[model samples]
Target: MQMASTPTTGDRFRQLIRSLTGISLPPSKVQMIDQRLRRRVVEYGLPDTEAYLEKLLAGELPQDELPRVIDLITTNTTSFFRESEHFDFLTGHILPDRLAKARAEGRKRFKLWSAASSEGAEAFTAAMVLEEARRKGAGFDYAILGTDISARMLERATAAIYADEQLTTVPRDLVTRYFLRADDPSMAGKARIVPELRARTRFRHLNLMDKSYAVDRDVDVIFLRNVLIYFDATDKEQVVDRLAGHIAKGGYLLVGHAESMIVRHPLLRQVKPTIFQKC
Candidate 1:
């Protein structure tokens, strides 16, 4: 008796994922993707990765499935205040001066966008800073909007729950003032952001690859940190242009400390390391 061969479904699946997401999957990632999407394959009644790729190629999967694929692909390594210097730049140099100038011009409100907000830390961190400014009588009306392609992470962001281990980078003062320690014994070592801080920021589902994004025209700042490394050069350009389009004139674009726009984009000018001003 002869048995049917179990095909190299994982390798083919990796290729399909790379084609769609521009994520170059290595042989080492085969098992990772298989584990992440095995349930989806089962749920779809697909026999193997080949069949799954066929469905994705044919657009037969539900709309939400694509983001699930993105979730599996995009690396979202982030923590509360993971890159602290950017926040320092915001508080010390950017906010104080931008707020003063806008107030003098009678512009009473501002908006900020955290374009690749993962797990809500960056957005909420912005809120904490803005809240402090507001309390100090800076008198600038402000709100922060955080968007990401990962629905799973966005759900966690909305829930505002975190283990103490996840918050190692957050400031001690913020941990004390903003997060309520979970009282239940089983949930000890966990905390939730206080309602006031949570209320100050909004989370939304946004895909960088989506054809259109309706960002507010007068956005004062955009933080799209540490996300461009995944995209190819062309994708990097497009995403930069899209995110930069939302910046109000004289507003700034902040990328990761190691990321840059030195690639001849006509719409931006470098004002500082990893910072660009919309022209």
Candidate 2:
């Protein structure tokens, strides 16, 4: 009789994760994976990681469970105005220049994309900057689109509610203008993004590994920050190449400072340490 080989727990989990989310977790991260998925394993009433892996590999797990698993394993660490310099550049140079040219060309709309926007902070920050520009006579209408792979994160983003600590870097004037203090006594230390800001922003679920992007094709700026570190070099190149097709001529791409090593594409030239301009 032929013997059937069984995959190790780490092998099974890694394969399942890559298949579902396209995130490749190395074997060294096995402990990290275990810690992250422990809650899910308990939540599903599975006795142990082995049981959870069995159901996941056998395709017997509920469809919705996959997103929840993704939520658990994915890191959604972000804060308002997390990368302050990018916002400064956007408001100080790019928006002003783009608005001036758009005005001369009679184009009145601007589009910005926060490609890996985590829990809406980056997108809202962009909106606040754009609104400030408008208030200062930029004379262009703008919209912001935020996309992420985590449905749970998207739900939190759609709510537009944030904790007090998250606003540490946000200026007092902009905070007063763009946020409403929560009235509920129990929700103390929390604030919600004002309706005007929310009105100018939208959120959607997106996976960068997909063959094509589902976003608007002519975006003027894309903030694909911080998220590229999770992808390998090949995946990074594929994502940047695909994202390049969606950017309008002369549009810009902003990445996190730590992601500078992998930000390379034939059509994009590095304009700053962490910013690229489409040719």
Candidate 3:
């Protein structure tokens, strides 16, 4: 009988990953991370994960390569107009209601955070809603900030290029209006978002697990979708508490449809389906 290989590099890499990013990985993910990062190790001319881990721990790797390591690990699975119902809610329920209330109170500015904005789709979706409101002559001033831990994903988002597969979720009319043909021959079956839309968004590096986030001011809404799945119970509570602190009084928090913190916390009150109001 053949014996299974020992978990030599696996244990060390797990510690390194968790220490650097606060992302916990299960045993099944060890081989996956190894497969994904082994090429990078070779590219860096490191003999093994132990050597790479040594350099990474010592902060001796090239600055640009560090982001590649993170990019390999961070999940960037997103599409335009994802969670379509939320966009409808923004138009039909949320924005108009927030606008009316804020205007009545003599406040015109609104802030939104796409806390796990992967590849800028959700962020741009919010912008499209705000743009629609603007076209309707609404006197609302807003800023939408898209933040992610993956610098590589953010760069792609900032560029606003999308594969044909990714563009299908985007509305046809909006695509024609907002996206221009790709100029590079290498970029077939792709479209790039026009400069106008890109102007309205700002991307930043943020780790949700980090205690020190710069989003100090209260925000009207936070679209923190599809992110809590990576955390355990304790980390989930910590993340929620930190996120809730940034929500403006009576503002809302939106998580992925699959995520639940209903019995998980006391400060959040469920309003509509998949939407929570911070008390």
Best by lDDT, which number?
2
The better-scoring model by TM-score among 1 and 3 is 3
lDDT of each: 0.79, 0.87, 0.80
Q: Cα lDDT of model 2 overall?
A: 0.87
- Top of the candidates by TM-score: 2
TM-score of each: 0.83, 0.94, 0.88
lDDT of 3 by residue, 104-193 (tens): 888887788999998999998888777777878887788889999998888888888888888788778787877788678978898887
Instruction: Give the least accurate 10-residue stretch of model 1, judged by summed lDDT.
Output: 257-266
Relative to the true structure, candidate 3 has a C-alpha RMSD (angstroms) of 4.0
Off by over 4 Å in 2: 1-6
Candidate 1, residues 1-279: lDDT per residue as tens digits?
899776465666666665665566777876776677778889889897668866876688898888787786677778777678788888777787677768778897768899989889888888877777778787777888899878888998898888999878877887888889766896788899889988778899887866568778778889989887766677778778777778888788888876875334677788887877777
Number of clashes recorded per candidate: 0, 0, 0
Candidate 3 TM-score to native:
0.88
